[model samples]
Target chain A: MKLRPSSLFLGLAFLICGCTEVTQIGTSVGVASGTITQGQAQSIKRSAAAVEKTFQDITPEQEYYIGRSVAATILTTYKPFDQEAATRYVNLIGQTLGQASGRPETFGGYHFAIMDTDEINAFAAPGGLILISRGLLRCCRNEDALAAVLAHEVSHVERQHGLKAIKAGRLTNAALVVGTEVAKNLTTQELAEATKAFEGTINDIFSTLVNSGYSRSTEFEADATAVNTLRRVGYNPEGLVDMLQEMQKRLKPGSHGFGSTHPAPKDRIDAVRKILGKPVSIVDQPVRKQRFAAALSKI
Target chain B: MMRKWLVVLGLLLVPSAVALAVNARMIVQVQRGQIRATPSYLASVLATVPYGVSVEILQTKGEWMQVKSLQGQVGWMHKSALTTKAVPMSSGSTTAKTGATSDELALAGKGFNSDIEREFKAKNKNLNFAAVDRMERIKISPAEMQVFLQTGAVKPLEGGVQ
Candidate 1:
């Protein structure tokens, strides 16, 4: 049967839209479960393979175009690093992290930047561009927490979420972003409803990405990917676990703050613990707290 | 006698080289689909060849095709994007797209912001072969200047490339 996007069984549907036909491949990976029929699972793999092929040969010039168009809009909306020293230092650090990470020569090189504002946000755009809001950096107890944020953002890029959104026409243009920021333009009644929708666990920005906010399971997948990424790079994988625990302490019953966009912190922490079930509780290289403190002292 | 012939030959070549001509640049529009360079599938973003800056072409693909950069890495963007634009590097002028006149000197110049309208006025004033010599230094090619000169009043020059 031709895989129809309408056949998606929840979370798997979100990952691979039911757009193609799949012939059954007989067996299933544990991840496929009841959510995916064998044919659906085959379609998902084919779709992922096709997407990889489509992205593999993008030119440096095309990368520049997407980077240029989005970078300008994002820069205009978000404050860039105010301190030149910190900006350059963070970029250098990002370069180092990128080299340490497996995919060194991405379409264009990866650039790290600190957004000038105090919003606890970090996002990765399609072309290896990472932006961490000052507020998020402030919340991190150490460099490892910062690494967790960076690693999470990296997973988003590696998974090509933005391109998929574009392919699906979920994002028509930057207008969707600009529209989100200008709440005053919304009628008072409209604003009230939006606030209600955004309150507590649902992240407004992510909720707006797709009609449904990213599922809890996708968050788990990303967290799993993040730990593996940090471990492969020789950074302590447990830093993500620690960061999740820290965020969990701050998350009140109804604090939608990060959860609205990210997963529930305590739930994620539990998930991480489950993944790391072993005698090894600490990462050999825990966050170098002193160096991180010294580096971020001025920010 | 050989030295005399060399001087005479040099004298002949110099005049033809200096013959009246103008120039222009081409900026590609991957304005859609995040333009990429592919002989087959995706549209390739035309960078200035030296230092790549993300540029949006003000006009759709122009034939004269002078790709200018804000950083000033100015050069001719060869239509080398397709099989048709593929020419041996040394074969004739790179800017001369097919059906270009031999007398036409392809311009590797960009008309910044609002220069397009003025360039057309310049081209129209010199359409007469005799007046073309005076218009040489301003150097905006006919393509960059075309729309402005195109009015119903001006009749087509009989028997030439459009």
Candidate 2:
């Protein structure tokens, strides 16, 4: 008789769901007396495996693991900025905006780092590992503008745009291989297959982050969320437009970084302007500007 | 035989009946998170829990769950930080069907974890795990976060849904 892994998982779910001790007694008694037929037990187990077929079903710990790899892959291209103070300042701004975002807390918590590069771009890996570039920082005219950038990245993480990049067929295949008997150590062959799936998942996200960029709709959603976050955090919502305008002047056609990875700045500016209702004057906050300048000094 | 079957039936039904009730133990899936005094991120932290630690759920309000740690400390944690699935702390144990979820087992350093990352890193030697570790090490405490916000005059709404 072929023992199905899903059937065993069904019993496991039952065991955890029942008062652990009582469920153990029940399962043992049912099996010993043959009161529950093998077919019924197998059917029960099959349904348990179905629960893990989607990206939404990917556990928080799983997302963290994927995020760690994605961040590692990104770091290979851009060295981390060695300035501690600058990194801390960006983290503070990112964390504050994250708190106001829909998902204030993620599995690994929100972490912000600066890549020591002249490339004007940012990447939000899954599970809140956000990396921004020094070139992008230089484009921010003030602290509010910086918050706008970080908030946009935080929105991407909050909405799980990175995970969405994973192809559906890949996730389904992974779920099948891993969900079956994942409760035990995988055999050598299974481990290889699971690792391959992991690599594919990572590549899907990395490619979207670096090569293709998020779909235009996804970028717009992040912008809209960032605007709301800025308002809730008491930063000027117009800072986003200001940042975009600055990028418009600096971004060269066919440039490598944001110029290649993102939608045209003019289009993004127009989208944000609709939300802000015609270009509004941005009030200068000196304290914010002074602190921003202080943080940027080493760069 | 009839009485034995009745008991078996009752035992089988117990899990489904109590699954939604209070006292369900949940695992902490996040690397580390604080249990706050209130159901808000800005609330005073009552305790901290590391990954794979199980906490007893006492109540839930919106996205916040009030949980009691093994140390007997009671506090609130965001739902995103907790998982209903069992989290395996170690590997090499093949005790199957003991109610451990597949996702739980996957996270036990066997699936898409440090073990797999080690394999991946070996294959792709160009990737930088060291920088990833440095990125993970960057942390900001709640007090420091509050101070930073105050310095910049970025005041979040009072009692706003965080």
Candidate 3:
């Protein structure tokens, strides 16, 4: 029963093509090639089918659209700051840090805006629309610390944390309107259903970002990731610790904004310190400090 | 018996070869992305590719993939902007019948697209989409970013694609 290598490849292809469902080809290929057990193949197929209509299936373009709506909703609550020079300065810092973030570019590209409100919070909508409040901006002591804040927010976008808030059932419902069988223009009824689903999706993320905060672990993870971004972008990693130390003094316990949406500053500082192992001495950068003052002096 | 099996194998080879070739193609999933002259984000833009265009992967470096477009333009693109799966494009409201498989069809501009956004906006008039549009337009050119980094003494990421 010995066969040539070409015959073996053909045998494997035969087994793969035998799969009735196109999605099962990968599993079948693995099985035919003796790479994966039958049980593993079944599990892989199940997981693949399960992922079809889930949040993971959301396309980058769709994420961009959802982010637009989310940013718009936030803008309704907090007016965008109208200072051109400051806005440009913050954007420069934000963009520079974004380049250091592992996921630098999004489908819609990264955009930064400052909110007029003095709430000590920042929002990173899916697809890279970041909204930082004036209150939060004022907390930064220097350009490095500002980089730390923007880096943290950018981490949220990079990890698609906003998309995680969408209810599983809502995603399934949304996928139904544009299911595999229907690729053509949606019927009016389908359009209506999709609109409803989109509304629910936005509300899910909005509530998590504003009223109810992310889990303590998610916040800790962002702080940890932000340190890496700061270090990678040539800023002092201790800048995150410095910003949190300052925040400890300003944030009121049981209050709204960052107090409501983030973990305590002390806890975040401790978590970041554990990752740092040794204290990262803040270096004196006259250039960074001077620009930080000039850009944010009026705000 | 050997001849009969050989015929069967030959019959399977044609379709299988086609399938293998198709699987090698990478599709651009982003709305628009620049193909750069090098793997770094700071490299000059060689060409801008739109969604649903297919490219052939030539090589890879760090988080970047070098690809050649159908028009014979070669450049590097970030891996995030591409997918191995086929992307079916629909011309607004018309059914796409370009022989796409079920998975490809499902991935077409479906859920949470512009149409749904338009519908949602029509129903809720209070949201400030104008601000969002303005925010999206505030882009920092690569040259500006270069100067900002140099002036501020910010170093590029070490050994990582920026």
Candidate 4:
């Protein structure tokens, strides 16, 4: 029996959908019918195997693990803030903002910590581990400002910017080699290769976070998302602009952490102003200010 | 000879049918989210959906999707809240009728998972897992969040100066 051209097309469609059994059956049938050559069948299988090539393919579990390691690495550089009340306050506000963000539920859920450093920086690791520097906290005048900062970091995690920073070639290579093998127990050799890939993945994220900052456009996008998230959560979007203005006063061009990692504070403020547009109404309660001050009094 | 022709016909028809069916179904990916009366977050919540509950996609407007729940309730949900994959229609039946493929399982399994993290930790001893663990332990309860929202006058709370 000869394979029909329609059958070959159907087989290709199944292969593209990553339906492994259907693809195998299709290929086998194609081969038996002489509709597809042996080489064609082999190539189809190879392409089917290449299905999980992008960063989007990283499962929630895998992202959680990556985030844990990245958080660990970050902690090696900055100590956790020892002030218990302040830490709790930040976590509450951060988590609230997270709940209102576009991508709310991650694998391990969103966790926010206040790093003891006064470097004026924030980091959002993949899988929802967020870190804010104590100095950055000092810049917030009210709960709205604090929520704005956390919202910005949440936007980064939501957008998967940290994961996007990973070199595509590295992820592609790892995905190709590690494809589906993660479900089964690995042999020692396979484990070693995957470990190498894992190391590469960590370094890629680390360098992007610590040394080379995200692109200017990416920073702008986070700022825009921050305003939107803040508004959605019923906080004033102007709080982001206020926070950026405060940072502009305290941070010089060559200062460490945020000053160096992000676009100029003035540039950010301008961008945020454009986003907010014409001083709309804000729900700024005096109670929020009092609570924010009480929480940060120890700091 | 009859069997061979039937096999050929099945292969050609099954995949296309499955593909068409799969595209119409979407599963809620978030732990919990609301199907709102409209696309905006400010819109009233019509129904709350938990993770893995399949909804049929009715329409799309920008980032929001109009979906029909199993109960026939129609509302808008954010595109980010749902996964396009067709979940097993029967919630409890664990047999292979879910239309999920082993290739997908393999794809999901592939990446920097727990095992890889263990190996990475062994190689890099200086990495501080303790701090990460401590951070994870700090959680805000729902009651705490509600009080915070109420005091701050944040929206979506049932009663508190919205």
Candidate 5:
């Protein structure tokens, strides 16, 4: 489905044209359709796909290096678990889930930990680093709920969603293709240009990237991955929905989510319901809830 | 005549202003030893500041260098402590040139050495964004101080967020 972007988005189309009279007329004529017109968005998709594919073509070593950088930045912004037991326990759950993921033995495994807060928030950096908030912990009545969040985040990393979003939402390549191996054979000068391109895309649409967030398709992909993961681990997929419904109730009328970053939770929750329409079979119990709660209590 | 003047001016300014663009495999000799602050350090470490790691030679204030790291982590170190080579290796790569530049940058440190190592690794490339975002949010909401506690790695190093 095409995204019906905010007026702020159409205004950006105006920015692409030269600031001549024609530019003014073109921008005025452009409108925010619920979806992109075939002409309007075809180029965007092609450019986004090319850039995204190019960005990931760098050596795996580079991926690890960049991951480390992003992870370090996260640590600066968020505190790690001070308590050794809690830290170790969170890591254990995370690693177990990581092992269960389709790609078990990544060069770097997933790292999850308890954030010392009461906010119902969780974040997964571009790498495997995942942060589960203390506030969010209170809402997770079962391990299924917790696993659901982590699995969704894991899918994001494996699928390279951030890389795709960063490439797609904002990037202006030259009319020329520098080379097929743009990312791989980048010289220092080329690297500088590439980094500038990287920064430009982020600077232009970081708000939309952060606010409007991932496309509904990516969210659905993550959700589907979460369900598959739950089944593999013997957890009921229904717990994901239960947790999401609770999120719906807990969120203030106007203030949804941690923010309007993800697709609406109610819509997601409904999708989950429709998928598991009858939820008839016996599924894994929320046995880990008490242990999870007890483990979190110390923080 | 205008072209002649511009060429002369560019040549004169560019050399002395020597970009010292952290060229790969360029060895720089350190003149002294001194404590340098690192983002990768939560608890201060008594490290042997190497000559090799000093990417930029800002100036000699007495027997030390006010050097800058690739990520903009700047600190003063005594000339006696650095080797004037590249940054000291927690391990350094004695490999080929050109591409070794990328390798050397990669060797900054692993989290295994210190929690700060992990922090540096986690926040690389996006350091400026993360820093600006966190700093601005903290300043705006004093009551939201609790959020900082969640995000911070440790208590203030030298009193403030600097």
Candidate 6:
């Protein structure tokens, strides 16, 4: 006997209702329907449950692994800054902002590194590996201003803008292959296909983060989020304005890094000013300034 | 038959009942997190929780989750800091039947892991895994952060939340 569509709806409702005996119900429905075999029904149910179709489907651990490779790739282009003290200070500030932000934790935790390059850029990899150029550090007039820059990068990771850049079809294909493979270990051919998808995923993130940059709207979102994150951490939101102002002064034609990737610094400053709703005075505390100076003294 | 319908109904009800009975548990997926006394990050930290530690979810407000640790400490953690997926409890008990589905496994670092990273690295020799390794090694302890906050008069210790 063929099962009615109404019965199918009921079955789906049962599934949504968190029925413990889903497999049994699915099998019975399939048998009653006379349209598909029990095995096909089971396979479908398993696939539905097992698949990871979008960027959101990527596990924190998977993101961490992806971030590791991405960071590695980035390192190939720039060496780590030689000053240990400066690196440590950046981590302290980054971690402080991270804890205060909406997302404090990533799978591997947030790590901050200084790239030795003079390029004025910062990148936030998928998991939490954030790299800032010494050139960007030079732009910061004080600790709070530096905090603003780190907060912006942290916001990018928090929003998963890099992950979102991955083409939808790539994730779908990866999920399909992974969901269907029931074996504990993938065969050689299966491994090869999955690896290719994995590489594509990495390439997508790298291009968005380092090469092409995110959309202007995303950069603005990061700036907005950075303001909130700065405020949450007791740093003055005006630091963002100050940093943007610094960037605006330094901007030149054909400049690479932030200048190339982001909208005009003037536009960003205006956007941040609009978000803050009023003029904010810079709170450059003596102690903060001293600490910031001491950290960068070696450089 | 009526008996079959009853069985289906029972099956449907059992899961909901089980779901309701079990207090929601979340594992700390981040490397480390603070259990704050209040929902805001500016609240005093009640405890420090590390990765894979399961906490009973008490309540949720916005992006924060109030959770109770195994030692009876209660505090708020960011929802981003925890995961609903259950991980294997003991590291040594490898084959102990985690009861996690393939989907959960796929999401929990089961398939795409260090091995894949190794293979990817072998293929791309120019990629600097060594630098990434060194970057990962730069860590700040919670104690160090506490000292930094204290010294710098940072928030969470400096009074009101902004």
* TM, every model: 0.44, 0.78, 0.80, 0.73, 0.49, 0.80
- Please, what are the lDDT tens digits per residue for candidate 2 over residues A136-247? 9988988889999999999999899999999877764455444524345667775677788889999999999999898999999999999998887778888898999999
Q: What does TM-score give for chain A of every model?
A: 0.60, 0.82, 0.82, 0.84, 0.66, 0.86
lDDT of 6 by residue, B55-158 (tens): 88776777887788877898888888888765323221221377654323434343455556767888999988887887788777656766786777666324
Q: What is the lDDT of residue A158 in candidate 5?
A: 63
**Local accuracy of candidate 6 as per-residue lDDT tens digits, A1-299:** 99778477657767676543555465566678786787787776656554437787776767788889888988888888858889999999897787677777777778899999878888898888999998888888988889999999999888988889988777654564444223255556656666777899899988877778889999999999998888777788888888888877776756878877888888898898899888868767667788999998655
Winning model by lDDT: 3
- A91 Cα displacement, candidate 3 (Å): 1.2
User: Each candidate: what lDDT?
Assistant: 0.43, 0.78, 0.79, 0.75, 0.48, 0.76
lDDT (0-100) at residue A276 of candidate 5? 76
C-alpha DockQ for predicted model 3: 0.38
Ranking the candidates on DockQ from highest down gives 3, 2, 6, 4, 5, 1
What residue pairs are clashing in model 2? A12-B99, A18-B15
Docking class of 2: acceptable
In terms of TM-score, which candidate is stronger, 3 or 4? Answer: 3
User: Can you tell me the CAPRI class of model 1?
Assistant: incorrect
Better of 1 and 2 by lDDT: 2
Per-residue C-alpha lDDT of model 1 across residues A168-217, encoded as one tens digit per residue: 32122211211211112333443333233222111223233323335577
Cα lDDT of model 5 by residue, A176-251, tens digit: 1222212133344544444444344333333333345677888888788877655554456777787787776765
lDDT, model 1: 0.43
Ranking of models by lDDT: 3, 2, 6, 4, 5, 1
Cα miss at B113, model 5 (Å)? 20
Which regions of candidate 5 are displaced past 4 Å? A1-53, A56-59, A74-81, A168-191, A194-209, A280-290, B1-162
The DockQ-derived docking category for candidate 4 is: acceptable
Q: DockQ: which candidate is best? A: 3
lDDT tens per residue, model 3, A127-156: 999999898888899888888999999999
List DockQ, one per candidate, in order: 0.01, 0.35, 0.38, 0.27, 0.02, 0.29
RMSD of 2: 10.7
